[model samples]
Target: MAQQARAVVTRAAIISGAAAVFQQRGYGSTSLADVCAEAGVTKGALYFHFDSKEALARAIIESQHELSSAIGRDLVASNMRGLNAMIVMTLEIADQLHNNPVVSAGVRLTIEAANFASPVDAPYLDWMKAAEVFLRRGQVEGDITETVEVCSAAHFLISGFTGVQVVSDVLTRREDIQQRLVEMWHMLLPGLVPTDRLADLLTLPERIRASRQAALGQH
Candidate 1:
């Protein structure tokens, strides 16, 4: 049992270290040697867990998707209204992109996937589906207008958020991503939300930030 636990810890360390390297260098520019040095692991140890750089990148991407999907699922299970949940989920993802090395690397690799031998599309598809569910529910509950097409709205939200993060990353290293996301919602909500609900929904981004800070303080 101890051996297994140690292996798990080692593997996690390798992944975390590789994520940081990948985040810095990107996929094509990164090498197994770079990962080894970053991880402070011998080549043999890295090979025992990941056969190649692509495998390591894929694992990081999958881990990122899992983290994001879990956030969306948890929000869905909560008592918050669907539109509010969607707002919070977007903010949560922005938070990850800003602070989580693994998620940041995964997103970078996924964007540059065509340069690699194997690319996974499921993560993008899964995220869109998750967002679509929230949008559909919001429309049904009248938190969003019936005129809004759920799938289109989902695509727009994801694409816009992705673009905003990329711009923020380049300009400010994502230091202002949370604020940029709030600004994005302000521009988008006018189309999706009723006038009466817009004021309430527009406040969600700040609330999400404050709530996260409070939770961190408690911990």
Candidate 2:
């Protein structure tokens, strides 16, 4: 039992350390030795936990997806549904990019996925599916416009977010990501929401930010 617990701790530590390195240095530049040094574990320990850096990156991707799924579930359970939930979900992800190294690393690794052998597109597929669900619900609730094709809109949302975060990371290490997301929504909502709904939904970014601050125990 003690050995199992220790193994869990060791694996978690390795993941965290690898995440930090991967976020700081791109996948091609990062080495197993760097991960070992960051993790404060020997090469043998790292090998025991992971066969290669790509394996570590895949693990981080799994963790990132789980985190995103949890956010989706939480917002839905709290009745933050439809368009509002979808918009805030993107902002929340931007927050994770800013604050969570594991998620940040996940984003970087995903962007650099050409280095990997197998497909790394599942996270995106899942995200687009979730976006479709939100858009579909929003349309039924009369918030999203009837002209907006749910499937295309979902794909656009994910692609736009991907580009936005990549740009923001280059510009400000995602320090300005939430505001950028708000800006993206500003342009996007005119097309997606009814004219009357626009005014109310425009305030979502600030509301979500305030909620985030409160949750984080910030003033």
Candidate 3:
């Protein structure tokens, strides 16, 4: 049991290191050696955890989703539906981006790398599958428009958020970026919300906006 715990710790350390390195150097430039060095593990140890750089990158992407799911798991548990839950989840994700730089970059890197011409791996497809599930949930609850293709919307939103992170330099100005993201989310949420709930769901807390501004001041 103790050894298994250590192994789990080591794998997490490796994935964290890979996220940072891939964030700095990008998917194309990052290598197994870089991950190993950053993780303070031997090549053999790194291989023991992840078979290759691709596998490490895939793990990083999965970790990002796991972290995000944890953030909004409450809404899921509460059976919150429609735009309200989506809004809450979106805000939570934006806050997460502010809080976790490497994971933010990992998300961006995953999308950026997926644009390649060649066939991609299963993990990349899994990321898209997860997004589809989120959007489908919204649609089933009558939040998202039935005509709207959830997968495409998910891709566009992910791509746009990646650009937001790059433009604002999330690491330096997290709050500012987060506020912009929230505003963007608000603008789009109405389209997804049922007409009856639009007005009420759109009314976010003034304190939330104020708190974001205050966070910007600190940065």
> For each candidate, what is the lDDT?
0.86, 0.87, 0.67
- For 145-213, candidate 1 gives per-residue lDDT tens digits of 888988888988888988998999999999988889888988998899878888887777677777876
Write the number of the candidate with greater lDDT, choosing between 1 and 2: 2
RMSD per candidate (Å) reads 1.8, 1.7, 5.0
Task: Give the per-residue lDDT digits (tens) of candidate 3, residues 1-219.
Answer: 999998999988888788888878888898888888998888998988887677777677677867876655665556655345544555567677667855676666656666554433543344345456667887887667787778777776655655665676645556477566667777766666578767765665334555655886898
Task: List, residue by residue over 95-212, the lDDT tens digit for candidate 2.
Answer: 7888888998988898899768997898788888889988988888998998899999999999999999999999998878888888888889888998998899877767777787
Error of 3 at 147 (Å): 9.2
Superior by TM-score: candidate 1 or candidate 3: 1
* Deviation from native of the Cα of residue 8 in model 1, angstroms: 1.4
TM-score for candidate 1, please give it.
0.92
Arrange candidates, best TM-score first.
2, 1, 3
List the candidates ranked by lDDT, beginning with the highest.
2, 1, 3
> How many clashing pairs per prediction, in order?
0, 0, 0
Tell me, by TM-score, which candidate is best. 2
- In the predicted model 1, the residue pairs found to clash are none
Error of 3 at 152 (Å): 7.4
Q: For this target, which candidate reaches the highest lDDT against the unseen true structure?
A: 2
